[model samples]
Target: MRRKIYTKEQILRAAYEVVATEGFAGFTARNIAKRMGISTQPIYLEFKNMEDLKNELLDLIFSKLKNEIFPVPHTGDKVIDLGLNYINFAKQHHNLYLALYVDEEGGGKKMHDFSFNYFSTLIENDPQYEGLSREQIQTLHTGTWVVVTGLASLASSGSINPTQEQIISLIQRTINNIIAVNETVN
Candidate 1:
């Protein structure tokens, strides 16, 4: 009998499906192989180890998110649009978003940096926040990330039961509050 060969992309895609559907804990060579209807050896051939596969999958996940959220000018207002898009992505791909952002272990520093940079760019260019200092802008960026990630975590985990509109509104209000405080302090 001959063994079937699987490409790295195929293994990573299978791993994504496994993680998205079954959570990070369910991501294993055996499980991914089973999902792909092949033996575990194919996965090993494609990845050095499970961690390698996870790293690749994380990259893929973040790439998709970046494509989906970035590169569009927020005509209404950059900050508000960014927050709305963040919440909308969370709701639409609850499991993937959880894996990418909420799952502590899987959601590594790269994901964090990607998110920070994404919002930081929005804050830097938005006319509404033009007067914010570097430190104030940094604070706003970090605070928004925390609020949005926290909101997604809470909503996904059933800790907060707000509708999508309500969640987006809350995030917008929080960002506004942060800006107001920054304005008074500056």
Candidate 2:
């Protein structure tokens, strides 16, 4: 009889699968072990504890998400398109999205910071945003992300299924409102 060998990479992959399907709340040694048809012992042996495995999973998820939303192609409307991309990502990766955003163990600060920079880059590249001051741009960027994240959370949870046009309209309205307020203060 041949002994079944499971490598750390295999375990991590399986763990991600488990999380992707079941969410952070459902994540457990038993679930991962069952996914791989192996004993829970290997999971513990691979990491110090569940937290360690979860941290690794978070890294993997964050990397994948960063790739999905960053360096966003020129869609003629970077801000609106980025919001649509975020919502679509959440809808597709609902469980993973919940883990990233809704789970008690939060790692969303990294995503938040990355979002600020991502929005900043979009603003910098676009000639339309060139007239805005740095502070105004930053305010607009942050406000638009609030819309994106909230819309994503709703979409991810199946609370709403807004069409792309609707999403783009909403984002445009948000950006415009922020600009208006910035002008009012100026």
Candidate 3:
């Protein structure tokens, strides 16, 4: 009798689910194998090692962040809308958000850099941001990202419980302040 072979996609899908639910601590060969109803051998066969699989997962997260989350339809305000979308994504995918951002120590830097680049591009393309210099645009992105990410973290942890409307209000206020300050500086 031949043992069924699992493809890389199958292993990654199971790994993603495990990481989403149980976070990095549970992201092991055994955990993924258990979720897939198979042995660890399939994972080993499909990848060089666990680190490779983890890199692939990180890439997947980055891809989602860029293609799906960042480019979300404009809602009259590109920066604020994108910021809101980020927080909303966190609110919707708490486990996934935590696992990707909070579970691992070194993982966030890559995501942060990716977000910075994406936000810079978004703002540069907006006519409303035309008056702002490159430095101001970068600063604005930093401020908005920090606020929304903090809000998402707190909301996900249930530390400072805020309604979605309240979160949006806070984000709006923050974005307004950022722009106002930048305008004054310029």
- Best model per TM-score: 3
Q: What would you estimate as the lDDT of candidate 1?
A: 0.76
After superposition on all C-alphas, the RMSD of every candidate to the true structure, in Å, is 2.7, 3.0, 2.2
The list of candidate 1 runs beyond 4 A from truth reads 1-3, 69-75, 157-165
Query: Which pairs clash in model 2?
Result: none
- Any runs in candidate 2 off by more than 4 Å, and if so which? 1-3, 69-74, 106-108, 117-138
- lDDT of all predictions: 0.76, 0.80, 0.81
Over the stretch 80-183, how does candidate 1's per-residue lDDT look in tens digits? 56766776677767887777776776677878787777767767777877767878878887877788777767766677777756766776788788878887
Per-candidate TM vs. native? Answer: 0.82, 0.78, 0.86
lDDT of 2 by residue, 23-121 (tens): 776788999999999899888888999988877877776667657664465456777777777788788888777777777754567656756766787
Task: Write the residue-wise lDDT of candidate 3 on 15-40 in tens digits.
Answer: 88987888888889999999998889
